[model samples]
Target: MKYFACFLPIISPEKSQQFRPQHLEYLEKGRNEGKIFANGKFADGSGGLVIYIAESSDEVVELARQDPYVSSGARGYEIHEWEMVTKAVIPK
Candidate 1:
């Protein structure tokens, strides 16, 4: 499995607001299914981003397509594959 990051731009705020409830529901389902690794919105509210792990880009794209926000034309999403070379963890 590979990890991909999806950036979503809210094109139609009104439409996005309308679809947000369903969108959140789908996100919860995706998270439960382990398709979503992590996700959040920008502090500025311009858009949002989601990190997902999937078998292929096609799968990621399909997931994005099914998002109500995107399907309803409330947002546009761009997907990018990520390559994590190294990581370090710090104890709090």
Candidate 2:
């Protein structure tokens, strides 16, 4: 499976907040399944991001559709296939 990044921009922040609990629950499930690589909202609160593993863009889109934000029509999103070329290691 390849990784895909889904960029979700909040269209209705208040509405999205109402479904936050459900959204977190869904994310936890995905994490436990090892399908979710990373997820977080932008520092400026503009939107959120999620990296997940999938075979194709369509599959990623379907998975994203399950998100409460999108399901509830409180956000809009775009999915892009990601290629990890290199990693940076921070010395502790």
Candidate 3:
């Protein structure tokens, strides 16, 4: 599996509050399925970052596109392959 980082730009406060619950539920679903690694909102509220694990970048992108934030127009997303040093990464 490989890691991916999905970035979402600042969303309107109404949208953020409207979608936050479903968004977090989606993350929990991914976590249960072992597809999610980590996630967080920016301190400055610029956006959110979600980390995913998948076999290919395309898979990660597809997953990112499905996020409630993106699907509901609460946000748009950009995804890139990611790599972490040391023990944070599982052995391939």
Candidate 4:
């Protein structure tokens, strides 16, 4: 199951500052666990997105709910499933 998680900031930058570290730590854990495939903030800094792989969209949402940004009310997120019809692979 692949999902796209789009996170929009809900609080001021100053308030969000307090949760950044924990949020990044949570992402790190997800990355290490292979649940997070890709993640980045928008160029305009409006928000960020994370690509997740899980059993279902519900599972992805549940995992995203644990993010400090979401848990602390600093950001709101939406999760959508992704279907890859084709992908390009780099040679090893």
In terms of lDDT, the best-performing candidate is 1
Give candidate 2's whole-model lDDT: 0.89
lDDT of 1 at 29: 95
> 1-92 in candidate 3: lDDT tens per residue?
89888898965767877998999999999988999988899998889899899999889878987888888888878888888677555633
Candidate 4 pairs with clashing backbones: none
Q: Name the candidate, 1 or 4, with the larger TM-score value.
A: 1
Which lDDT tens digits does candidate 2 get at residues 1-92? 89999999999989889989998998999888877888999999998999988888888889899999899988899989999665777223
Candidate 1, poorest ten consecutive residues by summed lDDT: 83-92
Residue 44 in model 3: shift from native, Å?
Answer: 0.7
Question: What is candidate 4's lDDT per residue for 1-92, written digit by digit as tens?
Answer: 56565555556676468898998999899989988877888888787888887888778888888988887888888777777455788223
| Candidate scoring better on lDDT of 1 and 3 | 1
Model 3, total clashes? 0
Q: Worst lDDT window (10 residues) for model 4?
A: 83-92
Estimate the TM-score of every prediction.
0.90, 0.90, 0.88, 0.83
The C-alpha RMSD in Å for every predicted model, in order, reads 2.8, 2.9, 2.5, 2.3
Estimate candidate 3's alpha-carbon lDDT, on a 0 to 1 scale: 0.86
